[model samples]
Target: MEQNDGLWQALDAMAGEATEYFQKARLLQERMAGITGTAVTDDGYIKVTWRDGGIDGLEINPRAMRMGSADLAETILRLSHEARADSRRQSDAVMSDLFGTQNPAGIVADKEGLQESIDMMRDVFTGAIGDSKDLIDRLQRRLRQD
Candidate 1:
């Protein structure tokens, strides 16, 4: 019989790499959860904190009430959007630093670009995992034969 071409070792290495990536992903998620995207008005009367996909805290100064209910509501809404955007930027920066990947919004030019990137990755990983499975099966068959 010929040599095995180190297939088993290669598989082991892939597994180790996958484990390391998952660990890093977990760490990133944990850090993201602790992040609070904050926004405040120019006068520092109104403040907003965004977390876990929504506004978590809002502070309105008594003086802000002088703007009337309508203006105050509009300011709050504006601050919420700003806070959310700030949160996304922070998360994207951290993810890019760790993974060498830009946030989809930053990298994509087309309207559907983010989804397209995701689809491409899904296809590539699916094909790779399928090919790896086939190789493993073939190796197992050869082992049984031997």
Candidate 2:
């Protein structure tokens, strides 16, 4: 009975430690909410400003506006996705700068595929769809044969 009691006490202590850690992380996140990062498309036609949650603003080039609405919309969609990816990359860089080698609590996990989750979350957090690099590659190659 004593051994069981001790085990439960230890578990309770660990849980308390975890809770404290999470609280500190939340504080850190709150403190970081105001900082912003800018991500421009590779072509410089679109620029997106983002923070912890989603895009704060978007700017489209006049050249982009010349296209028909459907074409402009598609291009905008693609650029938005790219901007979001760049935002995530920027966010990771900032977080790494802030946290060093330690993974930020609630932002990432210490397991395989966690990086992928981080990448996905970055896009989700920015409210953008992730690029289909594979599809782009295939289309690029197929269309180039003409």
Candidate 3:
């Protein structure tokens, strides 16, 4: 009976921690979804906005039309790349703040990290429930024998 009480206490503590971890992960995802990045050409001829892994907006000055087709296309591509890099940096910063890690890539909970966490939690709860069921069976058997 004493052993069963200790096991229940441990399971309760783990469940509480798992709940807190899940809430924090959800908050991080929401923040990352809302983040955006912007970049403007050095000549101020073009501007690009990046949000949620896609370009959200763009602006090109009329004077930029003077350039040949290739020049204009090149400028847009360069600005888009810059905007993407800016967005990635912003994302890294947010992730770093949340996880408190100096290494961005290591701590960022990408698809793999999120999946691993979910799997681990599932396994823990599964094991706890299985243990409780086995314990109850053993207790019932002992009571019947008595």
In model 1, which range of ten residues has the least summed lDDT? 1-10
Cα RMSD for candidates in order: 4.7, 23.1, 4.0
Residue 36 in model 1: shift from native, Å? 0.5
Runs of candidate 2 exceeding 4 Å displacement: 1-27, 41-43, 105-108, 112-146
Better of 1 and 3 by TM-score: 3
- Which tens-of-lDDT digit does each residue in 1-146 have in candidate 2? 45445555655785896787687577557656655657665677777776666777889888767769997677666656666676667666656765666556434566556787777657643432213344466679989997
Query: Candidate 3, residues 36-61: lDDT per residue as tens digits?
Result: 78889878889999997888999989
Poorest 10 consecutive residues of model 2 by lDDT?
125-134
Error of 1 at 3 (Å): 6.5
- How high a TM-score does candidate 3 get? 0.72
Q: In model 2, what lDDT does residue 31 have?
A: 54
Global local distance difference test of model 1 = 0.82
Off by over 4 Å in 1: 1-3, 102-146
Q: Candidates sorted by TM-score, descending order?
A: 3, 1, 2
Minimum summed lDDT over a 10-residue window in model 3 is located at 100-109
Query: Which candidate number maximizes TM-score?
Result: 3
Q: List the residue pairs that clash in candidate 1.
A: none
